[model samples]
Target chain A: MAINRLFRWITFSYLLFFSLASVASDELEELVEDLEYEIEDLIEQIDERNKRFKINGFLSAGASYSDSTVPLESTDLLDEVNFSPEAVLGLQLEFKLNDKSKVVTQLVGRGKTDFDIVAEWGYFAYKVTPALTFRAGRLRIPLFLLSDYLEVGYAYPWVRPSAEVYDLAELFSSQDGMDILYNFSVGSVDTQLQLGGGTLARTSPSYGGLTFKATDMITMAALANYKSWTLNANVATVDFVADITGTLLGDADNTFTSNGAGEIKFDHLDILYYSVGAAFDNGVWMFQAEAIDTAYENRPGPQIFPIQRAHYISIARRFNRVTPYFLFAQNRTVSASDRREADAILAQAGVSPFDLARVFTQLLDHTQSSWALGINYSLSPKAKLKFEWKLIGSTKGTVGDFEDFAAFTSILGGQDALDGTNVYNLVFDVVF
Target chain B: MINKINSLAITALLIASPTLVLADLVVVVHPDNSVSSITDADISRIFLKKTDSFPDKNKATPIDQKEGNPLRDAFYSKVTKKDAAQLNSYWSRLIFTGKGTPPKVVRNDKKVKSLISKNADHIGYIDSASVDDTVKVVFTLK
Candidate 1:
């Protein structure tokens, strides 16, 4: 219901602005000239405050195909080709109050979300000194190297970042937060440290949509750049309360006892996530690697509390306008003790044999590895085209992160538990 | 008449080839600026918004030429070791992430010079052929 209201508000705002712009179209040219003059006059009148404003936007459209007939988790990844999974558009506005202060806002619409506009970030910043800055309001959680600009497709070379590493933790990307950033130089190396604290309340589109409210979220990050090499390290922790609306576990009786109608609740869920990464780019060759670890604890249900560790390494070489890249990523989940405890409890609850099997399968640790080969071509200064072929394989388990245990086992049709999937994607991304 | 036209074409090609092969870009600042010389790394850091002030602690405001200008392309390639497209990609990350913004853009070298001359801390780049007394050349890329 809240999502609906937000969507309607954004739509109304856009419509009202367009209507007003159209009504004033005849006088727009003259009005623009007069506005410029007025701006100059105002600048002179308010000499102490220098103000500037800018607007920018990005768009991405793509089609993807997977060689599996069964859908992957709740995502729209099916056997045939599809366009709705990856297309997105975003707009950003910045109002510079002066050299030391500014406000920024960004809105994004995605095909997967039925083109509903969502506010991605809105924040105010003030520079305390050349070496220190402060920001407050809604901002991205700086968990990964690409977290700051993950939705801006034109900012990265690949059509998408490595999902194995980035999606290891089901955490909100943005929160109502305050952060302090400090930048300094040690000899010839540039270094930066960011410390933040925040709270989050959002409905994430994972697991058919899960609404979570988290508090006391704290984060710390450090980065260093020397010559052509850059390194980054980050850590974050949060305590959350979630109401699971989707059937994550195929059998609800074995998983959780609902407090009310469709209210599968978990309180005081604590999570910790950390990552370290390094990148090297020298105009011709580029290489990047990152390792992420996630742990979930303090849950009051038979759900799997996976302790996930994931990593990826990518290398690319540029030949003028074309770049060819290769990536390898893997994720491993450890939940043996958690699953054993859940199995004993469910057995004591007198669960049926078939339901017991399903619950145990869902609790097993899932592991998967993926490899991708792609090429990026620069069409222009603002546009790029990318094509990638990826292969994902699992050993001793179903593909982790791609599908829940019940969905994966159902797709297997009693075949071998190991599975392999092939996917291909072509995308064009631009920013203006 | 055909030979006369062929000679004219050859003359035009000869005139254009040198401009393409020998385009020199020079970074400029106001004449009153305290700093006289700058390293390529310093120039990159300034333009990329890594620092807001010069080594002398004076606030710096970098300016840029409009996209697709040859001088702009040459400047980035020589100073930052990045092409125009790469720079655009870099700026997209910074701008959308609210980390920093690209420099203010002007139409031509004359405007760059004019802006630089009006502010002692302002910095810009232009074709070496346009160098004049109004602006001081801090760094040159050939």
Candidate 2:
């Protein structure tokens, strides 16, 4: 009787335990289903949010070689075949909060800067209306037609923009401020106007890493489009200051210091700049031209600044997937009046004019003309291979864009020694 | 033999049906959209993000077929007058400059039509043959 009772008890306990286990298993499955649904919901939310974000990028990898030892143009290619001078990669991110506003950031890394990434553009844009927009933060100064997209080589027909106009504005590419853009259509023509102002502080690598500041800046830019033609004009002004030291000027530091100028500084200099550009394209043939002039005023020293002008004309003919183009560009700087004023100041200081002639020629007075012949072959819709052979010459002044200006001058002993230079560059540009 | 001939004819017709369908594109909007018809310039402006509203002051959201779609190519070429490379470059300029963004791209005409049919603000282009009562035809490309 005892054995039978124990057997019944064990059987009942086993049945109860099995029922409880089944119930717990059912709950576990339900919990898993609920968790999975929640995860799916979370993923769906993330996917929907991701749709409002975008990533776009552009890259240019190329090598440049110059015939002379001097690093020529803003490319800064020396005699030795080099790859870094012209290579660049950039990435842009945009996040749209809604249809009316977005945030954009562009980071660029250049071979010239040792692949150090820089935030070239970071701005918040708000569309007040369909025709008007307001942007604030770091923005590209609209000083030229391509200033907004200067680093994007795939957008243009040339491997690089014309150095004549770009080199002068390169240092002032972006500013921290706000701009208003108004776009409208008049009949069949489309017009766009941009006005902005900001301050800029940048370090000049060419000047031994000395820093310069520009304040009270203002810019007005306009563009008009009709059929195959586009015309744009831009004007800007700023007050500039540079803290200069003898050591930073390289070879000129000692010469100026020994001449009783302890430390050279340019303060409260007012500068005015303007540019006009036109482009025409009719599928097969394309033409582009731009002219820029910069004038400096309110100088505290006789050697403060000079008037500079630059212009370029380019024509391209597309043959199927390949395009062959030709460009002619000129850059000139005049400082004769400044030189006379410096001479008068030196005369009063018991210093000879001849002692500073080299200094003036090296810094203030120069002329450059470049003729480039190039071909662009579209590898794909987003990429191209470009080859450019440019001839750079000095018309009436020294070759001003070279890197080793003082050394080149000392070796040649005169401004006229550099007649010309031949530079060849092969680049691949892509946009995504 | 008659049955064989019938089957062969059906096969040939089936094989040739895709080519026979014309892909001429038509711009579309929701059935309840306020705008009845749109001009080519207005279509281009909407697709290119130049204007966010229609001529009637209604909010417009432009949708595009994914890149490399023939219908998209035809629509942009005919209306915006830009080829694939030119259009891409143009958008790249605007996007990189923080000026504008391209229209949201869907997979194909059917997707575009479905999306537009669901929202009055949505605008898209589709093949003429894909037009149905759910979406209104705003502009037809020549």
Candidate 3:
């Protein structure tokens, strides 16, 4: 009796909403679940086929060759120039609601390093009228063209996207949310207007407190893909909640220090994320590149500046399924040592002469640059292979630090040149 | 052995029977529809939610066969260059993520025929052999 009541309530609610909002005259969005078998039957008759769950993915393994003479702090590091293979396998179960919508769940296992149960994505949607559609649930942020299809390996011509643009932490961002996307034509270009915002809450040691409520984190993004030229822009702000135990206890001392006033000086960091890029893809050869940057701003002046700036350029050629591509990227960050470029700012704050001298010394030895190169080969619609090499260099910055640390600590100096390392990787990817 | 023979006989008869042939899926429109010819790409666009409208002025809505329907698979693959499993995963990424969905589906040939005949702005595909005088056939499965 309860089951019947629940079903009845759902039917009533569906009918109530359908009657008020439906534009297709039939108010048939609710028929999605009811028409599944018929869809399968028609498809079977026309194409002569049936349905079954499927599984597919790829494997990756790599190693690296680094210039050990350089310092890891300033440049990218590599212990050795060698080979290590990394592999991942993904399986998907798909349910078709009709020709337009489907329910799919994909599980991917990344070898070694990282493992977790991720929803990847899930939701329900439909278009009742040409001008309006409905979608609700956890979804991908369509800030970029690839945002909708980021996980499907065959969608792009790269083994792994360039870290410069792809690793911006803000682009692949997703959480529980809803959106309404409307399409209209501008002159000869077809455009889509996607307006959406959602709340993403996650708990980790990186943030203090109990990983509690941190809502109102807003994200707004848009994209324009006309012909071969595609451009995207997006902005989002996320607040970090207190994970005091993790931060304070995990610090050098497990106690909070105050200036004798019983008032705590805690760090609350908020990120201001923005990015824009454009690419051209018109069959044959394709040329693409993107520049992405993030500005980290803190509440107080004591906050650190990341000084991270990166971008990459790539070219690809597709001769049927055997498309080969090449990419190059360089990224760097300037650490805040209170003496790098704001010496006057710190000096004005009334710092002792001794600390000011120390700041100058710290500035002489900061990070320089990190970079990478890659090659990707698309073997087929379902599979591909990729090879990459990276070289990160730092001289004036790390050499001084290594020399100073060598002078202070005999152990690191007693060993060898306390500097850099290398890493190499290969990957196999696919879709089912 | 006798049972196997009987099953084969039934299967064979089912495939050859005219009664089981069903009806042609007409590419339809309102009787006063203005567009002339629609390329396969255009039809795919309409059904895949890539593009909407008759290129004249009428607002358009796509009608689909049910999910996992063999006919739906054939049509999608013919245009989208994707297999059945791939399409399933594609829609999952969209629908579950609340991005987009396929078209609303009609049950069988009879239901599709009725829906298309009643709505001029609606377009759908059915078995070519099932075409009748009551509906207009805009395109055929080549």
Candidate 4:
């Protein structure tokens, strides 16, 4: 920690000193002349010493609103609508090692949500020439154009993410392995083809007072993009500690076998997303959309988790200063066998978590739709302001939200999922 | 007093109306060049670093006014449909990667008019009202 701090200070002071020197001698003609030369020299040096490395990112700060007469409440007192203190921060570094190889890293830390390091990806790439390039490293699992920038937090259209598409994958879809990318051109249309596979590691857990080590994970994915159309598909099988009834074991790995408790299960998950993203200046009318489906095996205790299906569509119209958008998203994930099996396990476990099973059963019966109304104002190229109001009412009113709309509700038994209760947001974001 | 105020308002309108009219920059090539009219999409393709040459058989060396010029803003808004910051981000992605750089910016109208005059294959934009015999107007912002 001390060494890292010392290094940061040194780099910061060097940057600061040069900036001051540039500013302090601005008016003198001779000094200005020398400064220009110095600047040119320094830029050349940066080019020579640095291997095409570049830094970029964004930051956002905002609040939210609720339709209910009173503002909704949440745990952190951070994301409350009428007023609150929360900051959204993100940063990324791209190191261009050469024409064919590069490294990219990004970090997202938000104040409203617990601040932590999340979504780190790095890979080695080889250009098998301009038309054919191959890369083998952990990639952001190319599901969407926005997927690579998903966690950069400041790179999107919402204060928080759309949630519909952002949360499609339970854990990030990155894997440890190799991929091949081919960029080609036919007449006027640009085409890119990518095919590869990799083994995925379990994300190291460091939050929510409980830790989970994503265990024994492997994945394979294929995707292609021709101009505005994108096709993506991937599947993975992972080992997990099944939800046991009675004990509150801190670590699942050490206790899974010896405790005479829960069973170790293999979860095979398959996901497919096909999207057509197009941009046209139909006189400033822009649109983007993506459709997706997900399937889980053993969702109901390693045997019968049922097939959950969902799709989301979004459209946006831009008129100079204001961009308003409409979105419709849905999920149908109710399985009687899965719910009953979960209940039976919880009822027998004799643990405090049993109470959650009843709520899950109710949620299974309802939750027809999740949609949002949003407005984004491009006050300037450097700054943007966005307001989003989501309507997440359950088909069976008191079902999905744990009987709470105005106060904090534990929507997911996992404890990590956002309290999908009713909430709204006002976000001010910028990228420099 | 009302009469005086009206007179003053009329004078002000006369003074400001020309600037308010928003002169579109007509991006053009020298007259002998083969490419005639270009679509906003083609223009966007060139400016966004998606292509290195014009639709015709010409090597396109792009020229622009200073970074924050209103005419520049108007031109990009018409072609790319992305605001300035968005374009800046797009350019950065290309520039820092050595894939491309934004067109070299000229300081004023005279520089633009002269540069386009010198190269038949070059691409550039200047105030539409500022067009002359030296440059042929091709794509207009509006």
Candidate 5:
């Protein structure tokens, strides 16, 4: 598989780099001794210089058990207690060439990716001025406030960010791109502005094993901080494309496949996403909330592109080393008209009764909400242990993001419809 | 004899209270640096790496005391409005994102003074009792 090959390549590259660094350090040690330099001072100098090029990382392992099955392609939520859903190890290396220029790279191995190493970020940054910076190469898409460090579990209070809000935009977290950032102050208010453009592609089983590609992806963000409060607004637009092959659609459409297996191709599908968020953290009490709206246009075939909206609010109060938090999140799809049009198209195509029902369910507008209560206990400055219990409820339609309603019903042998489920998670996160 | 012992204990408690409540922490820069005084917010910004330059437009290189030092904890809580653990978490975000790095760390007040004496742009903090001509006190957090 391509993922297996990529994993092997990354492992080999890390070994090669380590071997070369060891040899170089040995040679430098001999030279320092030969010159009769003060060994202690020379060693300190070497350490000081090495500190400029820093390496840091984080590891998170979590186990989750849900009361009912939320089944999807390739994975199910209620397969007993499982750890693969939220287990990852990330390593970051930053090389500062000078005061104004640096290179940074982060590699992450995730259980969901079959433990394959993937490059999360690799970028070059240059400081144009004290307040202005430019970065190029692969970078995180600033779609949400926590987009930059979404995978770094130790950076946030939750075992995971709310699935209702996070999973909807999870497909496009990174882009091969360039961005400009500027930080300035206006009357005691610290403000930052970022503009970026890039290309991105990812394949996900949530979307029926289809590969989504976007071109000319543009993003902009503005952030302002005053005292203990921070506010952020973000907007992004992209031209998306995807090819739906017969293998992906499977036997769901047997009549259409009989006529020489045609592929469903969508080109120049435009998508726009906008979000605004605010956070208040004053060392004791913390509050965060965000609302996002996503719109899609220009879809071909019987596919219905819906306008999706999501919001989440979380509050936590610190008590010494322990913090308990509460979160409420909701997601909805607004596409009743589009769903009716898709149903009409399927009916005119002479689709079978079972296949037509499946397609119709996939296009239906759905709503889901979740309420979570959690506690975070700091084991140390760099480590934390968290426990969370969440209750999720959904309407009868297709529960689109992490759990699909159709799949849940199918897993239940079509005897019972899934309306709600409880999930429990325990996680250990550390940064080094 | 019991009264005499109680009187001695009271004197000890009175002496220790001032050290806990009045540990004078002073921010310092090189003696040659033109920045004579800085606001508490500016000191916090410089130490947190929110702003890279000082008020006088010179490049600023902030230094920090080694971890576990009382002076370090006091400085962060008073100026940055964060505890040591909170500061660590804050820096972790910046470090992992490649946005900024934490300041260089020295062992004690003597090393802080030594480092500041060599670099005009260097900034550090020390106990007020350790203030010397080698470093200029820019802001005092007491």
Candidate 6:
């Protein structure tokens, strides 16, 4: 009887253990299901966040070397290779306020400037209709085809845009303005027309970070896209002034003063810009050309009203993952060298006019031409590696945008060495 | 009987050559969409975000397959004449300039059909073999 009782007890305990194990298994499954739901909810939350805010960025790291000590396109390459001149990173943030309105901000950091972050774009845009858009605040001054995305290296084929055309009007990069964009199609061609105006208060980094301020700035642009071809035209005008007290013409002569004032004020100056560009790409081959002219309408001083015309043509062909490109560019000051103002200023300052006249001629009679052969290797769809060899030249006895011309010529013992100088550039570009 | 024979023939062709069927893509819209056909130019214009409406003046929304998909490559090459790199470059120019944005991307042909079938304004491309009654074929790749 005792053996039978022990057997029954063992059977009951076994059944009880099995039931408890099944209960625990059910609870475990429930816990896993709940975790899965929580994970899915988190993913949905992240997706919703992404829909409201978007981020994009681009980076370019470039190294350059030049045979001469002259800076090209603000690149401080002089015999020794320099990496910081072209190294830049840009971040763009787009916050979607609604289906029809958004805010965008872009920040760029440059290695040359010690990686100082600068706000290149901060604007609010509203889509009034499918074909029209309105934007206000700090907007890029779209004077050229690439001017809007100049620092976004992955947008174009070159390590840097041809400096000849892009460098001429560097004073106007952005303006606190309002613009309206109208898009329409004519036959098979897509066209966009932009009209904008505002005041500009910014420093001209290209001109040694001089304080540049403008009023009554007006700009108009047109872009037409037909299949693989894109054509752009732009015109802008501004009444501006710059602090040219320490640099440029004023610095040429220490005794030089404007109206006996300690500093020269480039005030009440009227400037005009005209630009035209065309680009064509057919999967295998690409071609681009742009021409620009900058004219000072008000000639307060003969040396002050300088007119410049520049152009560049680039042709490239793609071979699988590699592309080879060739470019030719030229820049010329169309204005004649008139040293009348310099003579007057020198006479007033009781300084010898001969040296000042020569200085004015050297500075005003600028001419430069360059050619480049470059190859770009696609690291991926969003990245590229480029190597370029470029050579620049000028007319006899001219410096052609090179700073400290007198010292450079004296170091070379003659002006013939300034005729042609070779520059090498290597760049890696990526967009995300 | 003719439709039955055509289906049989297509099944035979698919069984005989899968790569050919893979390249055979059909642009689709919701079944209720009134638009029946699209021209090559209009297709490119819409996909490129150059135009936001169809020929019938109905709002058009474009959807894209994930990057690196061979089907996406073939569709873009045949319709828009743009490769992956070129498209990226084009959109990069637009995005930073605040000009426009590219189309929303889905995972695959299945997701494309699912999305297109749920919205009358949505348009996407899928393999011809995956075409079903849920989505209407607006254009067939030639």
Interface RMSD of each: 10.2, 10.0, 11.6, 10.4, 11.8, 8.5
Question: What is the C-alpha lDDT profile of model 2 across A1-432, one tens digit per residue?
Answer: 434544555576557556655566566555544544444444435556786888999999988888876556476677788999878999999898898998999999999889999999899989998788999999999988899899898989898998877888777888999999998876556689999999999887766676889898899999987666889999999888776654345444344445544324456778899999999976678899999998877654445345789999999998867899999998887755655555455566776545543354345565778899999998888988999998886645565666545435633565343457788999999998
Sorted on DockQ, best first, the list reads 1, 6, 2, 5, 3, 4
Report, to 2 decimal places, the DockQ of model 4.
0.12
lDDT of 1 by residue, A47-136 (tens): 323337778999999999887765654246778889987899999988888889999999999888888998898999999987899999
lDDT tens per residue, model 2, B1-142: 3454575695467346634444567999999998999998888777877667787768889998877666677788778877777687778788778777788776666567767777889999988877889899988886
Model 4 agreement with the true structure over A36-126: per-residue lDDT tens digits: 4444445434544554776666677777654343232221332335443336566666676776666666566766455675645666666
Q: What C-alpha lDDT do the candidate models reach, one value each?
A: 0.77, 0.77, 0.51, 0.54, 0.77, 0.79
Ranking by TM-score: 6, 5, 1, 2, 4, 3
Rank the candidate models, highest lDDT first. 6, 2, 1, 5, 4, 3
- lDDT tens per residue, model 4, B22-103: 5566887777778889877767766664554677735667777776666777777677666676675455444322224477
lDDT of 5 by residue, B87-110 (tens): 877888788888778998876677
Q: Candidate 6 - CAPRI tier?
A: acceptable
The best candidate by lDDT is: 6
- Which run of 10 residues does model 3 chain A get worst, by summed lDDT? A255-264
Question: What is candidate 2's CA lDDT for residue A224?
Answer: 87
Q: What TM-score does candidate 2 reach? A: 0.80
lDDT of 3 by residue, A311-398 (tens): 6777876565455666665454444542333344434545443352323323233333334455566554345566655444333334
TM-score of every prediction relative to native: 0.82, 0.80, 0.59, 0.64, 0.82, 0.84
Candidate with top DockQ is 1
lDDT score of model 6?
0.79
Regarding lDDT, does 2 or 5 come out ahead? 2
Residue A167 deviation, candidate 6, in Å?
Answer: 0.9
Each model's number of backbone clashes? 0, 0, 52, 3, 0, 0
The DockQ value obtained for model 5 is: 0.24
Interface RMSD, prediction 3: 11.6
Which ranges of candidate 6 are over 4 A from the true structure? A1-48, A205-209, A246-248, A251-265, A300-303, A340-358, A404-413, B1-21
Off by over 4 Å in 2: A1-47, A247-265, A300-304, A340-357, A404-417, B1-22, B29-42, B53-60, B119-122, B136-139
